[model samples]
Target: MVTFEYAPAPESRAVVDIKSSYGLFIGGEFTDPADGASFKSINPANEEVLADIAQAGVTDVDRAVAAARKAFSQTWSKMSGRDRGKYLFRIARIIQERARELAVLESIDNGKPIRESRDVDIPLVAAHFFYYAGWADKLEYAGYGVDPRPHGVAGQIIPWNFPMLMLAWKIAPALATGNTVVLKPAETTPLTALLFAEICQQADLPPGVVNILTGAGETGRLLVEHPDVDKVAFTGSTEVGKAIARSVAGTSKKATLELGGKAANIVFDDAPLDQAVEGIVNGIFFNQGHVCCAGSRLLVQESVYDDVLARLKRRLATLRVGDPLDKNTDVGAINSAEQLTRIRELSEVGEAEGAERWSPECVLPERGFWFAPTVFTGVSQAHRIAREEIFGPVLSVLTFRTPAEAVEKANNTPYGLSAGVWTDKGSRILWMSQQLRAGVVWANTFNKFDPTSPFGGYKESGYGREGGRHGLGAYLVPSERSGR
Candidate 1:
């Protein structure tokens, strides 16, 4: 048996005062759901029940939509974009001021490493708000049209992987474009969104401008299908995203989906092996491989296969896997029981399909959901590990002979979210970028994101862009840019 030390979670100073049953945030206040039912939010690290959050049913979704509609028509939509910019600026500053508290809450609720939450997640959340804040009053210069008007109300549903950051992605641009919003945080990671509701209160944003209703799949369905919601934005599994697309078919309600990906990181024989190794590690294992654009498939040139695999195994052995709150921990717990099951099942399929599996000889924590940093060798393009999005710390290695072969194998997926290339030749990098079909291509790097750059996907990875000027499209009315 492997013994591991488990530390108690730090106490929070922010008013965790919301009842075990948290109501919907409507009109600048936390109000009870119309049906008054609630669901439990669990801590995946130890499977403990954190709190019961209000489950918004169809009636509650209608009520939330009505509140958002009222704000849009009476107050928010009427406000000048410059004035709306002030509110976003305030929210950004508040996020910066309360960064520590939010980071802690996010890590506790989402099971991501605290070091990541404090450094990467929270900073990026603030950065996203700050980035979009500058654009609120600059919509005219954004090339959307002469007078870009807000799309009355937006209904957004974000996943559990990056709670606070996703909230910022959904809320910031919507607010920047002068739209009111009713956003749904993933059922498991509702705390940060609820905390954000308090942040909005501190910023004194107008009532009904932003409302949060926390619940499971049914609640999400209600939000997406509600007749009054002007637009719907979702980030999750591709299956769910396609369902939403079909649900919104023939309807004028605007929708954008940021779905799943099984990205490929290609390393050529001429590449710097050390740098490629680092990129591979950060690409697949960062955020415990919970990222949508995780480079789960690593395609390496056959000439350097043995050397690269040896180095990769050695590096993975040194990674710390333990308490999410620990600053030294490199890999954290799996997001949930369901996610772990899926990862294990796919990994088993990889083994049964005759691919060789490898793992570091390290012990994992006993309490939380855990998976060893895994790698599969001799993987063919048809292998499940190479095809499906494991969404865990599992890397599938496929050897290719030439640059053309690498690109062909890398682009052999329904997902086109992201791809990575590691080669010393600049021409090869440019060539691979053009051929890869993914939205974001990292040459000599992997998994790097910026607030100013646009990101989304092609094919089953879903549609539209999330950041930069492209993001403004989701919040603007069609007439604003449609005709002269």
Candidate 2:
């Protein structure tokens, strides 16, 4: 294997001034943890300790929820919807202003390539706020009837994979609908969320309208079960999501869980080979395949299966796997040591179950957690890799002879988050889309996200949409209007 080399520094380090230690953002101010417990946030790229992060204990969680409740009752909920919208617009502009710095910080904290953070994640984060800001004052026309009520204090928990983007998804809608928030970012990727707190401060948002508590799973648990919280929104693993669902069961709190997936990217015999190949690559390799809705399973028609697999391998060979800061790099380091172990174990299981695995000649950095882009052929529906969510830059290829068989294998999994169908015939695309059980079905593309559209899943992938007007409904209570 050829060892890859990269620039010593790529302007990412000097762009943002990272603090030696970070405190929790509460009541529109930075405050130390009540219990004084802390953990080190590190760069997964090189295992360098980035900063000391405060661990929010039980008291801290209580304080955050209290702060949110107070804000809802006193300041936020009482404010006119127009005024609330002005703050959101200001925050959106500030995000655009600090886009480069936020992108660099995200790459440093999260192990995704600077390209994705700069282009996809940061842009969507800003767009989401901008999109929701427009809806703040016009929510009465949102099909929820006139004068819908806010959910009060919303306790949101975001995953490490897309920290800032997921933060926008949860916060924008909640605030636009006149709710206050106490959110907890994932332990490994809390920097961007803390930075967003600073953005809120810059926008002069009312104190306690947004509170960021930093910690691990226990902290998230406390936030979910916080009695004062009126609603909960989370994006993470399915197992943890189930625990959260159980925690809020029989309670008045409403919860929306955007959980796991093993999505099927189906390619018909008539699919444009070039475009289909790119879709397949983008489906699984984007974000190192950490997306909950990643198309990890490739279902190609048998007639073109060999051709699609060949093109996929050739394209994978050209993918650059190196420093995230390198503009040319396509694949970056894994998010954390723990996640790396999970990816490796799942890949090993695929091999042990008799799937044919292949990887192009590439080199991984020695100092960081990394994995080369890998694909497995000769995979069956029974294989663990096909059945489980690997959540890595790994693709499992399976073939079908007919559209009926394709739909059967695609819907066989417990997950129904998202899927793709690629074909030249519009009728086939329409037919396949209607037959697929996923929430979002793309005809000729994959992994495309927009702030104006709703995105979520079915079955084990969890429920509740996270975008568009449908997302706004999750944070509001319909009034007793004549028609809903």
lDDT of 1 by residue, 298-338 (tens): 99999999999999998998888877776777888898998
Q: What is the lDDT of residue 265 in candidate 1?
A: 95
TM-score of every prediction relative to native: 0.95, 0.98
Q: Against the correct fold, how does model 2 do in TM-score?
A: 0.98
Model 2 Cα shift for residue 440 (angstroms): 0.6
**Model 2 spans with C-alpha error above 4 angstroms:** 1-9
> Which candidate has the top score in lDDT?
2
- Ten residues in a row with the worst lDDT in model 1? 10-19
Model 1: pairs clashing at backbone N, Cα or C within 3 Å: 27-208
**lDDT value, residue 381 of candidate 2:** 95
Instruction: List the candidate 1 regions with Cα displacement exceeding 4 Å.
Output: 1-19, 478-484
Q: Name every residue pair that clashes in candidate 2.
A: none
